[model samples]
Target: MRITLERSNLLKSLNHVHRVVERRNTIPILSNVLLRADGTALAMKATDLDLEITEETPANVEQAGATTVPAHLLYDIVRKLPDGAEVFLATTPDGGTMTIASGRSKFSLQCLPEADFPDLTAGTFSHTFKLTASDLKMLIDRTQFAISTEETRYYLNGIFFHTIEAQGDLKLRAVATDGHRLARADIKAPSGSEGMPGIIIPRKTVGELQKLVDNPEATVTIEVSDAKIRLSIGSIVMTSKLIDGTFPDYQRVIPTGNDKEMRVDCQTFAQAVDRVSTISSERGRAVKLALTDGQLLLTVNNPDSGSATDELAVSYESDAMEIGFNAKYLLDITAQLSGTDAVFLLADAGSPTLIRDTAGDDALYVLMPMRV
Candidate 1:
């Protein structure tokens, strides 16, 4: 394909599309990006078969053509060019090599016939709804840390996305768990998603979507079917096949009627956990929380290492309680807090503890306690 695209625009699009291309591929064309000059824009597409990303940018299309070139190599070449440099990409008729030129630098990339590239049918999207970029990022960032990496439970390797009833209203929720801990967050469901089927978005798709949602003001339109989920933003689109297993019913795990409540500064509590965790040995990753009369003491003890204790003033009036939790797990839950304080509701020492923002009930978190 022959086209002249701004260096910055080409690099920007390539940076996003190249990441979707696997570093190593058994198929030759899989390592390359499909470049098609159509109308007045240049389209760049890359895929690993499981997921695909396509981006379009404004370009001068002197002669409409298409070819496949090494994704990473093209990105690297354009990245090194001087800022504001205009990049000219041209493919010879034989389609054996593609040339890249910017100012004084020039490089030739080996090309493959676009016909050899595996084609994915861009199925007609049945449902489309818009989400603020920042909201989508929030959905992924807050819960992705809990996604299970265990190969045995492949279905738990992604965030379980579904609609749930809360306070007599339906809300879109994202939940992730690795057996030990779980994170759940919710946002008001869009108008068109009332009856949409729940889907388990794979971890990789969650990651790519995070990168694509950099603009908070940018609204992404999402379309989903039984097997596929597609996201469109501006001039970019990402599609992935959803995981096909039934996600465990998460509602049974979120405890109800936890009455004992404790409120503490989220930042201070997180820092206390960080400091005490230092004393925990590599094998035993537990931090004990002892709460009484408006005070919270975090302690970690390791025979080989040492013991640490940090006390912080909190708002708790319930009976004295002591519970143990994994330091990493505590940090993950605490990191989700976006406000000053977090309110934790505890039923007892052995039951799951519920956490939420002290200011409101927009989102809630639950953690199962460990024996100290």
Candidate 2:
């Protein structure tokens, strides 16, 4: 295969596809990216068997052919070339090596037969829908932090997507939970998503999709089946395998009867928690929240180190109670809040607390308390 393309265009397409290639692979062709030149474009593909990404860039194709080369190596070479430089890629007659030439720099990369590269066959899609980039991003960003990293419960390692009827409307919801915390977000269901089956998108695929939905105005097409999902944005296509286990009943864990309400400035509470936790022990970094009438006091005590306490005024009318939470977890939940005031609904020191934004986003969070 032989092709010539702008360095910027090649790099942009490579940047999108090369991330799917693992750094180490047992199969020789698995670490390589497949390059095919034909019909005035060069198509680049990279995969780790479970996930695949493909992108096409405008190029001057001198010959219609295909080959595979080291993904990272090709990316590195193209990245170091001068801006606006034109990159020329050509494979040798014997198909043993591919040469890259840009201005004064030249390099040769070993080539593997394109036939050896594996394809992630998407058998049949049962549902297809379109989502605006902003909506998709909102659902992912709100719930991604709560996805469990535990390998034992593979179902919890991904964000669960499904449709449900709530408040007399069909809504598309995304939910993610580790054992300690849960995040749930919803959007008005799109037209074609009404009867779609629930699917658990794996963590890695969620991460890649998150990066691609940067343009808020762009539209993303999603095709889903029971075992796999395919997403397309512009000239890029991504296909990934879904997690193979049933997600737990997340609705049971979201507390519904938390009666105590505490309203505090989100930024102020987050900063106070950060300052108090500075003296906490590494392993036991729990911040204690003591609330009484309209006053709130944040404290962190460690026998091995000094202790800290910060007091602030809050809008709490419930009976006095003390609760402890992991300082890191508190910060994570606070960072996702968009409103100035955060409302926390609490039942007691031991029950889960519900958090919501005053700005009226369709997202809610549940956090379990830790022992002080």
Best by TM-score: 2
lDDT scores for all predictions? 0.88, 0.94
Which residue runs of candidate 2 sit more than 4 Å off their true CA positions?
Answer: none
Q: How far in Å is the alpha carbon of 123 misplaced in model 2?
A: 0.9
Q: Candidate 2 on 1-372: residue-level lDDT in tens?
A: 888999999999999999989898888898999999999999999999989999999999999899999999999999999999999999999999999999989999999999898999999999999999999999999999999999998899999999999889999999999989999999999989989989999999999999999999999999999999999999999999999989999899899999999999999999999999999988998999999999999999999888999998999999999999999988999999999999999999999999999988699999999999
TM-score for model 1? Answer: 0.96
RMSD (CA, Å), each prediction: 1.4, 0.8
lDDT of 1 by residue, 1-372 (tens): 788989989999999999989898888889999999999999999999989999999999999999999899888888899999999989888989999988888899899998998866767766678888887888888889999999889999999887778888988889998888788888898777787888999988888888888899999998988788989999998989889999998889988889899999999999989999988987788999999999999989999867999999999999999989889888988887888999899988789998897655666778889888
Clashing pairs in 1: none
On lDDT, the leading prediction is 2
Clashes of 2: 0
